[model samples]
Target: MKAKLGMSPIAWWNDDLVELSDDVSLEECLRQSRSAGFTGMEMGRRFPSDPEVMLPILKEADVTLCGGWFSGTLVNEELAANKDRIEPMIELFRAVGAPCIVYGEVGRSIQGDRSAPLAQKARLDDDEMKAYARKLTEFGEWCAERGMPLSYHHHMAAVVETEDELDAFMNHSGAGIPLLLDVGHLVFGGGDAMRAIDKYHARINHVHVKDLRLDVINGLDRTKQSFLDAVALGAFTVPGDGSLDFEPLVKRLAEHGYEGWFVVEAEQDPKANPPLKMAEVGYKELMRIMTAAGYTVETQGFPRG
Candidate 1:
């Protein structure tokens, strides 16, 4: 199961905090991503909604549109309304030939709220958990009907942040819904990333390979700081620059036959970290780890069901 490597545009320009890298152009982002050795990238706020407008730019840089983040409010909104909002993004992905759409359940999420503490993030009760999972399953099925698989992102400050929360969601959610295992978030949220892969490997169809700085994470007061606050403080970084050990996770993914995009996604200040340099570092480190794990890093071809 060969995997393709991709980078997220959040490294160049953060979606939540537009002020970070607001001056960087979409062309420069794509160009620097390609130059850093990533063949593809996830969509960003700077990207055009129209595929015809975006595809030409991507083609010029010789990069593929791997996927894009879709904010889902399934827990609060009606399924029909959620579907209606997502249909256009789904169409855009289909037009650009993206393999999947990354779904982040942002209903009542405080990840973006600088004043809201991380520890006080909203969580669902047992019954609410089951209902949310059911809605997620239905949405996943709807996406599948349109040739796009839904990869659920267990994001920070979301309802499904912790390991037990992730477990409940995965167990209750139907098999049609796939998990997008993000190593950095799992570790940052005080969960074992490798253990998660071991338990949920079969359901994981997409991957986000950001690394965490444990020193910064250990010092953070979850009761006072939000997820966005942590990002501003440099709690996350590319693979080699952080405290995470990627070899074991990479080897496990290869051994389990996990195939898809392993995107390097570190939400940080571009001025401080330098997007192009950090991207190259991430690309090289991941390649080294994957090679050591006896997996060939394929630079072409998207994963298919």
Candidate 2:
């Protein structure tokens, strides 16, 4: 999988440096990404929510927009108001010329507490999975008309999180719809993150290269803390800084012939320290992993010492 590495600029924000208001140095972020040798980037939501402002920046940076993310809450309900929900996002992606949108399926969860005395979360059976797939397939077809792919992102709060749920989601979600797999989230959600990579490698459209700290996850209060809280607590970090085996991960991707972007997204505060240092750590480790797996960064012809 000779993929380009891209970074998200959320790490570039400094709460104190700027009120995080009128302007953000999007150009500085592009410089950082180019400096890091990435060929593409996942534009930050704050960078430019409107295409008019963002298009020029992306063109100037010479980086491709490796799809943006749109999150919604749906897991326990059938996708109602589906068109109303996704249409704007479809238009947004089309307006910006992004080839795809890394998306997650979420709905309200059925807390046994919906009545309260018992409250154990229920599961989605195969029938529901198929229905969900049909709905997703419809969306994919719609996006296809516009040359945009809605790559289903399997997130923690999603019905497609656990292994069984993952199986069901795959079983039902339309085939040929590209999947934007996130390694860290899969591991956090207690799924064998690499198994699917090897099994359904052909459906992969893009990837979010997030790494996890199993220890942090293992310590969570399984009942109260929301998935977002866990992420906020540093459960995720850039690859190589955590406990994940990239050799097999990459091998499986290569075996499947994946040619997409591995966008490195670490939801940590860079200001607590320095963004570049962590980025350096991330870039070096990413290169090491790629090199070990025999995938080079298509080096810019200045031979080495």
Candidate 3:
């Protein structure tokens, strides 16, 4: 049960805010990730879709393609329609040997609406929750049939953001549907990350080890600022540089026999926090926590030269 370390390109180039690092090339992102000691990296918007083109670049950097975010609208759209949107990405992930597809429900989400208040984000009632869970389960099974697992990402400003909502989804969803436990989003959404790991340990197939700047978070006016606004204000950072403690949470995951990609994702302005430096900070902190927890940090695909 060796755990592998990976990183998100968001720290370097934000997919939501394309202007963050519009000039940074895809080659540079992969290079910086590998140089920062990440053996794997999740795909970004700039990444080539053709496997023949992307695989070679990945091989040159010696980094594995972990996966990328997939915005799902199952809460409002039909499963068949959503399948059409997800199937192509599934094919790409399967071709590249990725482990799972990170699914974030964005139907009626205000995360990207900078002018929209966070408190006005969408939410589902009990009946709507059950319906959404059923649709998610069906989609998860569809992915499993295609050789990829669907990892549900609970995000801020989305319908399923709070701990109670997360619990309801898990309780109602089929056993096949797995969770993508994202620590920073959980905290930002007013949920306990450690408690989530402990409670949903058995169903968590993917992990996003993002840390939050609590001082900034505490000072946020939810009625005025949106999730995107928070990101612009430097709300997220590498695990060690932020306020959240990862040691106990890491240990808890290890104790629960969780072995998967622990991706470091901090969506920040690259000018304020250099991507390479922040990548190093995240890699070092994750390695330290994993090592202290008695989990082997696998570096199999990393380039030596």
Query: Each model's TM-score, in the order given?
Result: 0.97, 0.82, 0.97
Residue 50 CA displacement from its true place in model 1, Å: 1.1
Over 15-43, each residue of candidate 1 has an lDDT whose tens digit, in order, gives: 77876664788899888988888888899
Q: Which parts of model 2 have CA positions greater than 4 angstroms off?
A: 12-24, 72-80, 109-122, 298-305
Q: List candidate 3 stretches off by more than 4 Å.
A: 302-305
Report the number of the highest-TM-score candidate. 3
Clash count for candidate 2 is 8
Clashes of each: 0, 8, 0
> What's model 2's lDDT at 207?
84
Q: What is the model-wide C-alpha lDDT for candidate 2?
A: 0.67
Model 2, 127-232: lDDT tens digits are 7778776677766676677667878887665567776677777777666467888888788777886887876677888888888878888887766665655655
- Decreasing TM-score order of the candidates: 3, 1, 2
